[model samples]
Target: MKFLIAIALLSLSSCAVHHHHHYPDAPQTSAEPEYGNTDELYADEQDYVDDDEEPDSPAVAYPEDMPEEEAEPTTHQPEYPQYEPEETRTANQPKVPSVLQNCDVENFETGWIVAKCGSAELFVQTGPAARGSYYELSNFAATYATMVTNQETAYWGKRSAISVNGARGESTEYQFRAMKPGLFGGGTVDKDGEIIAHGIFTTAKTQHGKAGMLCLTYGSADKASCQRYFNALGKDLKELGRKNGPVMVGGVALRSEGKCHFLRPRELACSNGSLTWQGGSRQALENLVETTIAKWTDDHGIAGFYNPHLVTKCTIAGQTSTCHEVRFQGVMSTPAEIRHATLLEHQSLAVMCTYSTQESAPPPCTKFFGKS
Candidate 1:
């Protein structure tokens, strides 16, 4: 029995030795997939231990050639350039009065005074001051004009007259009433005083004249330019008197006393805005146009202005206006004129046609001053 026990013990010892020989270099690690070599396993374990042990200095790999960063761009602006309307004036010229910006235009058929200055039909509205916006220099070719009327003789049907305020000693009695900014005779008397750049006769000063005047408005009246131009044209202007005088309008001679001179028709161009014609009758609203908006009621007639210019060989309502042209012979020193406008008289409203000497008139002012 003792000998049998010794054999069992020997067999157990041999089995234990064999198991140890098979895995002689294997690591005794708690981690799964243990390394085959104990030396390699120790080195890997040391690297992981170093990362946890030193928090301040990490062992991260970095490249040698890393590029530097660029700065972002900035945004800024420069200051310069400012402007004013007065720049249009020159050193030699005296500044004229600026035009009033108080124009409210609706219709010329009512609340107005119409002055039939033998040669021209002028419409004027006094007092009832309105406020408006000022503009830069507008040319004579502009369709509208702002007029400063003298309260005394410049009123309706009194025959245009102006009593010079500063030039009391000179006593320049003007025959025409209204004036655009620039045309003051040759030069001016008081170097600084506003000059009487151009002489305008008030053929009519109706309240509703705002319609026509508003239609002709521009950004600037440019009195300086008008004065320069008037001096260049060199036409003789006088306060039309009761006496008879000869004025050459066309090739034919026309009778006049005030001898009111007109601006060069060609220069009368440039407009800031335009008017829309609200239809009415030519004959029905004719009289009403003298005093009110042309609404076709039983008592009123269509208020239509005689075309300031005479147009021949033109068509209206698809027919020639030359046939409708009426020439007055006997009326002494009366204002006769022509127009190139078409009227839809059958309706309740009469629309005024757009007319200006600035360019080729739509129908063209073929005839002017009632001349053949």
Candidate 2:
């Protein structure tokens, strides 16, 4: 009986060990995932949704402490408008007078040529001389008129001069009497209130250093036609002077009061206010001018000219000249004290004598000195 009881106890112990070897039941696991998540693990594998379809999830709100994202900056550009050029517009514009257009080419002449443009008569001449303020051709005309008509054909100074702005450039215009009574005037008055056989001569210096002249006569009661023709020729001459270099000064003869003075290049003169030249050493010329002024003042019972103060320096005839203001006591009072400009050059001296009451010298002195 003791042996049977030991065998039963051994069997019961083996059965208990076998039961302990089995695993405990996994804690409540289901086939679905935890936290009830239904989102796809691999989004690329899912089918694309149409734009019209509603989204599966609603927008999430950020926490109060979470930072907000900033939007990206965008750039904008500007647009501009364009217009036509000025030169192109000017080229398309119409000319006021067609006849004046071709006058430079068709009616152009080196010497005197009378161009009869529709209802206009133009007289033109081109000469050689560096541009000067004086009108040389008018001097010749005045001389010829004086000899032929026996009338005083002297130039009437600055009063007979006019400044004209032509199509090309500036022109110096001079008024003079034509030889024939009906030459340029059929009883027409000129700009200077002169109702004789009067005409105009326009002069200009080209950029190329040449000189040109254009002349026209008042042929009718209306002076507009004459002025128009004169301007046309002047414009042509200015253009021509640009191409043609220096040329001759056709003719120059100055007649003042009853005296006539013929001039050469680099020499300028007039009655009372004159540019007299002396060929001598500078010292000799100065001495001569001083002596003459002193003697004249002494003879006239007036204080002599003294105390030369240099005014400025200028070029005349390609030579440099020094100008001075020489003061003299007035004949009667201090207000009458006079000052004049005298020019002295190294090789040749050009003396300008002018009489004026102003503290400064007259136009002849200032004009020649380039002050004007």
Q: Name the candidate that leads on TM-score.
A: 2
lDDT of 2 by residue, 107-136 (tens): 211122334344333443333122222223
Model 2 residue runs over 4 Å out of place are 1-199, 203-330, 335-345, 353-357, 361-372
Tens digits of per-residue lDDT for model 1 on 1-372?
Answer: 110001111122112100001111101111112111000001111110010111111101111221222311211113111111112212222222122112221212111222322222222221111101000011111111212222111101111122222211110112212322334221111222232222332111122111111111112233333233223212211111111122221121222101111111111111210112223335543443332221211112224422223334644334333322222212324322112222333333222222322233221123221223
TM-score between candidate 1 and the true structure: 0.19
Residue 37: error of model 2 in Å? 99
Q: What is the C-alpha RMSD of each candidate to the true structure, in Å?
A: 46.6, 49.0
